[model samples]
Target: MRFALSEDQRMLQDSLAKALVDVSPLDRVRRFAADPADTAADVWQALAEFGLPGIVVPEAYGGLGLSMLEAALASEALGAAVAPVAFLGSVLAPLALVRAGSEAQRAEWLPKLASGEVLAAAAIGEPIAGARDGAGLVAKAGKLTGRALFVPGGLAAGLIVAADAKGGLHLVRGDAPGLTRAVMPTIDDTRRLAELTFADTPAEPLTSNDALAALRDAGWVILAADTLGASQAMLDKAVAYAKERRQFGRVIGSFQAVKHLCAEMAAELEPARALVWYAAYAFDHAPEEASLVAAHAKAHLSEIGRFIARTSTEVHGGMGITDLLGLHFWFKRIGQNRQLLGGPEKVREIAARVQGLIGA
Candidate 1:
């Protein structure tokens, strides 16, 4: 029942944060927004160099063979900077694949994913939510044909993981025939979202419809972990601003209202951290409940994380929105997370359904 970072986890977390600060600083995020090639290659290499891309994979597959808790720790550190690239898709996408793929499939695909030789982007969601029949979404047969919006780093991805009409996972080569994609601008400058279209694209089934139903739920856990890191960054920014920005007579942080707000942000962060870790633990120790915990974590963290981000805008006054300051970066990150996998209401309903609160 106890949740805390082990000694090695803490060290690795610090190392991951420091490494990103060195190679993927805030300035890099801005520049990358203008030029997509600025730091991705280095960042991608750094992740591989640090054994990051392989954390959740088994050791035999050329990975660190660590658990989701370890991967979540590393992910949280990257989230602090709103780091470019979809670490989850590149890392966790394969985990889901290995869990459901055939022995031949696992032997080949996992090692490539672990060593960073293959990068996969999860293609889900649509901007309009309708280019096809209204369904839960699915990937079927040996072909996947659909459009997905907001694919993270999708422009550079070499593989595309998608869901077809049956809600099964289909792994399609990035260069497959009848496939095309476009990068779209997003509120989060550090992240890249692409619009992807597939027309009878060749695909390899990663998992069946029933199995995908579960992995889809687990996606919320990874998203929640990222949200927690973003909330922490916003909280840090608000505190630093409160201390340095002078008021009528003294620093605003000295005032009771500002202090209370900061304290509340801190309190909210605890629950976010606990829930994320709980979700990670479920992924590691109790796969049965990972989906439920993922829904709970996403629902709770999304609600509070948005509150923190919104309050930070007010705390920083008008400067919060301006490029002169970087608060908008984290604010936008929160916004992205809110709608990335699903909104708070959708996840809460999932949580409710899991507990049988309402009949399906």
Candidate 2:
């Protein structure tokens, strides 16, 4: 069986990377991060023109009708650029609607989401419908009460797919009555998070019983892929810096210790790239294995991404921590990806439970 990406997938990755380089370079990301008010509107527009917002939406709904593998590829490119766009929600919201939404829901929202006319966010991180921060939503009589934390793209989303305490999915409009949103600050400013409070806010329930499982699997795969791209970028930056920086009249890259650090990072990360690909492929092809594989990918990449971030920074010496080279963008991106959804320990526990090695 072929385990490699098809030629078309490679082309897609290349094109997206090039577009991001032109539109969201490190300097542009820095400017966006410096100002909380800057929405990175032009960057998101470029992505919309490239069809990223609609990559997985059905072609009938004005999307490319691509698979999760393609969406994961897009995520990898976005991670490499560290672009300040609300992509996690853009992808997840459409996936949720596709999997569980009624005909009217899809007909009403998918087209607008695909065309970038409406922005959407997904607040499904709660595993058992409760957040680690003691925040969660309760659904009653077609309304939601309580709160959701760490909602990506919540501040600007026109629609939100929230999971309730019963593991049910519901859709909430951004302008719904009694709905309130507050931005949640994090170390990584490129991706904005928000806390959502719903006070008997009206909601529309999705019909599928299995949508939450599918959504979680896809989330893990995408987050793992994002970490993969960001890790590779940091490693590349470190290698480039090592080659140029001289110590004792010789390039630092020539030192045995530096060579080992670079080699170790490559050795560890290169194989993990295949892990992410397989997880994504499983999501689209082998539903039975998707959950376990995605959990492994997310957990493994979180650990590896952190290692790469630290080692890559170490390679840059003092400049790594400094803002001059802007290495912290990739660093912080990796760090944030590590904790999003579920961290390594939490994901590993899920994997173990899935395998029946532990009581669920």
Worst 10 contiguous positions by lDDT, candidate 2: 125-134
Q: How accurate is candidate 1 locally (lDDT)?
A: 0.77
Winning model by lDDT: 2
Model 1 CA lDDT for position 89: 79
Query: Where does candidate 1 have its weakest 10-residue lDDT segment?
Result: 127-136
lDDT of 1 by residue, 1-360 (tens): 445778998898899999989978888777776786554777788878888878877888888888778777877887888887688676547766777777887787788888888887876543112233432334445776667777776787787777665456777787999888787777777788888878778888865546565555556777788889989999999999999999898999999999988999998898779889988888868978887888888888889889999888788888888987877778888888877767888777767777899886
Compose the digit string of candidate 2's lDDT tens values, residues 206-266: 9888898888888888888998999999999989999999999999999999999999999
Best-fitting candidate, measured by TM-score?
2
Return the number of clashes found in candidate 1: 7
Error of 2 at 355 (Å): 1.4
What are the TM-scores, per candidate, against the unseen true structure? Answer: 0.93, 0.98
